[model samples]
Target: MTRQLVAATKALLVLTLVCGVGYPGAVLLVAQLVPGRAAGQPVLVDGREVGSHLLGQPAGGPGWFQGRPSASDASGELSGGSNLGPSNPDLAAVVADRAASLRAANPDAAAAIPPDALTASASGLDPDISPAYALWQVPRIAKVRGLDESAVRRIVAAHVEDAPLGMLGQPRVNVLALNVALDARTAGEE
Candidate 1:
């Protein structure tokens, strides 16, 4: 009995040290190697932090192009999808409501509602919206900001980041980056 107890205690101590201390320490070291990414890739304006390009935020209003609906309310700490499947009536209802709101906000917009605009992304904190979605909101943003439609379109076009390695993911625009660029353009006009 004594021998078994001693062996069990020894195994417990070793596992605790490895899992609770060594594993965490190693993870911390690796995260330090990529500080900016691990720090959420903060977006800066005039040297002051405005937001992060890595996390989506609620930037509603006709003057701005919005990001995807966030099931987590864009909270990085609580980031996750709603886990509602496509066939779920609750999800369907939310999508319908989102579509209605989009139509009301952008009555002048001619583009069909983009899927990203209706469904919350899996991470719920995704910082980007599809170019289609961004362009779809161009008319409304232009009208509200009192800028020409072509100018808003040009800005959106300029910010369209190419897919990684030309194939990995879809072309995307960071909502915070796009909004910051818009702000800069708007400031230039003032």
Candidate 2:
């Protein structure tokens, strides 16, 4: 019994060290070494860091690009999804309100509202949105920034990232990155 207990204890310690410490350390090392993906791809603006590329944030001003809806608190540590089904009345009301706000903000835009602009993502922390969603806000953003619509559209186009591996997913625009670029451009114009 004593020998058996010793053997079990040794095995448990070895397994714990291997899985908990060694595996995580190895992964971190590899991630840091990867090109264009190190340090979790933090977003920067004008030589200063603003936010991470993995989290969503609120861009309340019309001059900035908006990110996906977030169920997290303002600090963004406690993240969650609303989890309301499509038929849920509360969800429907929220969507309607968002749509109305978008329409009011872009009264002159001829394009139909995109779903991503109105609906919350599943994680509620998605950093990217569909390119269509960004385009939908171009008119409002351009007006607020006092920039030409074509210029805002060009900025959006420049920031649009293709789907991973060319076909693995839909094209997306990283909202935080785009908004940073917008602010930089505005600063340049000043």
Candidate 3:
């Protein structure tokens, strides 16, 4: 009994140190090796930090291409979905409302409104939207920005990031990056 107890105690301490202390230290060291990512990939504009690429922002205005409907008010702090299942009346109502808004905003957009535009992502901090969603908003964004529709569409296309390694996820557009690029273009025109 004594021998078994001693062995168990030794194993616990050894495993705890290795798994808890050592593993975390190694991870921190590796993370430190990458500079911008280690520091949370801050998205900067005009040398001033606007937001992080990993998070979402409340991009409303006509000139901006909006991301998915964020349950967390587009801030990453309280990231989560609405928790309403598909059949929930409330969820349906919200989706309907959102679809109506999108239609009203982009009357020229003939494509069916993308699901990403009507529903919130599981992580309310989704900074990206489907390419279709981005394109759907191009007409409105161009009209608001006073730029040609094709030019704005090209901007959206340029910012469309492919799936990681060509297979993980669908191609999407980062709303923050796209808006930043739009701002830069507008500034250039000024």
Q: After superposition on all CA atoms, what RMSD does each candidate show versus the true structure?
A: 1.8, 2.0, 2.6
| Among all candidates shown, the one with the greatest lDDT | 1
lDDT of 2 by residue, 127-158 (tens): 89999989888888988889998988898999
Q: Is candidate 1 or candidate 2 better by TM-score?
A: 1
From the highest lDDT down, the ranking of the candidates is: 1, 3, 2
Q: Tell me the lDDT of model 2 at 115.
A: 84
TM-score of each prediction: 0.90, 0.89, 0.87
Supply the global lDDT for candidate 2: 0.83
For model 1, the superposed segments whose C-alpha errors exceed 4 Å read none
- Give the runs in model 3 whose Cα sits over 4 Å from its true position: 1-21
Per-residue accuracy of model 3 over 71-166 as CA lDDT, tens digit each: 889666788999999989999999999999989988989989999999998989888999999998888888888999888989998999999999
Model 3: lDDT to the true structure: 0.90
In terms of lDDT, the poorest run of 10 residues in model 1 is 53-62
Across 1-190, the per-residue lDDT of candidate 1 in tens digits comes to 9999999999999999999999999998999999999888898898999998888898966798799999889888989999998789999898999999989989998878999999999998898989999999998999899999899889999999999999999999999899999999999999
Q: Which pairs clash in model 1? A: none
